[model samples]
Target chain A: MFDVSRVQKELTECNRDKAISGVSIALYEGGSDLSHLRGTITGPVSTPYEGGTFLIDIQLPSGYPFEPPKMQFITKVWHPNISSQNGAICLDILKDQWSPALTLKTALVSLQALLSAPEPDDPQDAVVAKQYLQEYPTFVATARYWTEAFARTSVAIEEKVRRLVEMGFPEDLVKSTLDSVNGDENLALEKLCSS
Target chain B: MAPVPASVARQAELLKQDGNTYFKKERLGAAIDAYTEAITLCPDVAVYWTNRALCYMRRKEWNKVEEDCKKALQLDSHSVKAHYMLGHALLERQDYAGGIKELEKALDLGRGANPASYMVEDIWQVLAKAKYLEWEDLSSKHIYRMHKLMEACERALTSFYTIEDSQVQNDCEEIASERLQQLEFLKDVFGKAEQDDQPKEVPDYLCCQITLDIFRDPVITPSGITYERAVILDHLRKVGKFDPVTREPLEQHQLVPNLAIKEAVQAFLDKHGWAYKMS
Candidate 1:
């Protein structure tokens, strides 16, 4: 479980700050006992994601404070740091910027800033990152496309992987085999599981 | 003992070679003795540490493996095999994150970048057996056999499954039963290998991609060893042996890491903000 007070304090601070806009936030803790901790962020006026109500999922690590909590995008966006398949956000602060001095409000502000101007050089999504670096326009267009496709009602990759699995193959084989085949979900499970 | 002869270095090298030979032959006990003797003769050499670490690894003495690997690194931090063995030792100890770091270093130092194809068949067998165990009941061994038979039938749903004909189910059941028995015997003989041996099935291409991914860093090739930094290049060239029709290196068909997986893995490092180096 996380320090709920700290998270709440951060949420309140972000809400009060007008600059931090256009993002929705939600917090979850205690893996099995998942009670909706909180969620709220408005879309920013500036940036490509402007007018977009981006949903953010903040999951506290089993050991919070000592370790950093997880922050992912629940709303689909074409950011270099977020996976298009799943709204997995790649943030340095969330992972490495874990100073006790930094609060959830500060993290939210950072994420909002990231939306305005993504660090193309240091991207979480390599494909997007690479394209962003090499061909900036294409990356932006793709990001926009993905945002339109996924951000409207963002879904998780696990659901997609599960859907593939339900087609008759074992989950373990599906994942392992899909990885080797490099995202080809239609691969025959028999060939993958064969000795 | 008055003065160390020039031949002493040569003698130590010879002993070290002998230890490596034994290590390769899987005569671990002898390899250990030979490496020990070489170390006793010349305590400063790095290869001696490497040779002894291999022996320790064969014996499953992970602590000693780590100790020897560290010693080798201390003597020569650039030694690729030293880092590779260190990664293996760390992995055996279930220090996955640490092990991964060491392995990344090993590739950076020019050791084999990816898990070799040699590891695939064995790893698969192990995974299959584990899956078998999981699917099999704790209550009855015979019932377990029956379940495995059903599982094999389901596997036959695709053309990739080799078993054919009307009696295929019974034949598969018989083959699976015998193999499971043999596997149990092998486990007893080897004194418990890892549960899922399935060769990490890390594709040769993935290994190449990972190698390219790690090598793409500017810091990797600072001292004019840029192209040769990732050991995967050599392994990739060697993958020619696997192809009979080509009869030459499969240089063209190889998949280089496109910018995405590279950035993702790098982001993983950057996001973790974890610091790591070759040593």
Candidate 2:
């Protein structure tokens, strides 16, 4: 059987230091089960993706910890190694090189690292990879534009969390629930009550 | 057996001393031989069998350990080492229920021993793993059964609307309500198991890095990193042939039972069985 207790432990460990780790995990919007989760990563500094708050959808297989957790970008990202259409990442660790030693936090950090150093050679999106290799300036502009369009919701979510916390919900719970609902205050409040 | 001759008993004592020396030096093969000779000279001595069981345990000859421990227990029913070794042997063979019972017996026998004796703590360690394994297995099966019952309830409720007869429909509705309450009760069991959700985190090292759950059977690698035994074995077979962290070439045989960590985990659970519903 897949180890749910281990997933619970990793979730606790990963979210212990959210500010320092620059990554966090929460249950997906409507699911109470532990297998499905949402991961957030602060885009690495000095990269075009920097300052962006990226959301990754995490699905743990039954052979999880033995198998790599399936991760995809929910918030659209423009990187050579990430498919712009569907946000599929072509990272080795998530595939053949997966190790049980690596937690979801490490995988998210690796994703952030992939953002900083995009591998255009082994590309998930050939169009983006071509832009990255042949037209570096255009690549940077498109990546930055995509980040601005899709990933700059950290401040908005923070504002929503502040409002929800003011409404007497616990800050951490409100924060996670608010982000998962995509900043819809009414949906978050409804979801929080049920959760 | 009849009382032994004095010189023959003395020779048996001398062989036991030789076995002790061999055991201390980690020469389990020679220790087993010495203990065998000691048992041959004085078959009634319970410790001679238990000591040889230890040597067998060290060699991972679990069946031999089981046999020797059984013999030791038959000779001296109060032999704690016999129960402990037998329990461990049973666990190695996946007899969790029997292993847990034997470990509990060992615990009952050893709890009031002197401060210098570590047998109580050792028994607690094995007991803890045994209990945890049993709890995890049973709880998961409980969840699966509850889900099936819930699905049955849903189907009955859905079909309740389609029934032409009012009497049958009312009976179906009643059963559906009972099933709903049953599902609630099952959910509450899970809720109660996780009752202490505030300000408690399992210590990291007590957990396997792979699964992050508490160790069931911990095995240490050549590089000193430890993992839950089943997890690491799966990694070796399904993933790669090297250590995940150190990247050192590792084989299945190189993984040694990490008794220290296993004991620590067992101790922790023994103290806080309420946290995980380990009892």
Report the Cα lDDT for candidate 1: 0.55
Give each prediction's DockQ, rounded to 2 decimals: 0.01, 0.38
Which candidate number maximizes DockQ?
2
RMSD (CA, angstroms), candidate 2: 17.6
> Interface RMSD in Å per candidate, to 1 decimal?
21.1, 2.7
The superposed Cα distance between candidate 2 and the true structure at residue B150, in angstroms, equals 50
RMSD of each: 24.2, 17.6
> What's each prediction's TM-score?
0.30, 0.54
- Show the lowest summed lDDT stretch of 10 residues, model 2 chain B: B270-279
True contacts kept of each: 0.00, 0.83
Error of 1 at A143 (Å): 48
Q: For candidate 1, what TM-score does chain B get against the true chain B?
A: 0.45
Q: Which pairs clash (backbone N, Cα, C closer than 3 Å) in model 2?
A: none
Q: Per-residue alpha-carbon lDDT of model 1 for A44-156, expressed as tens digits?
A: 55545644556667666654433555777766677777776677777776875454334555566677788777886777778877887899878767766755554432223
Give the DockQ of candidate 2. Answer: 0.38
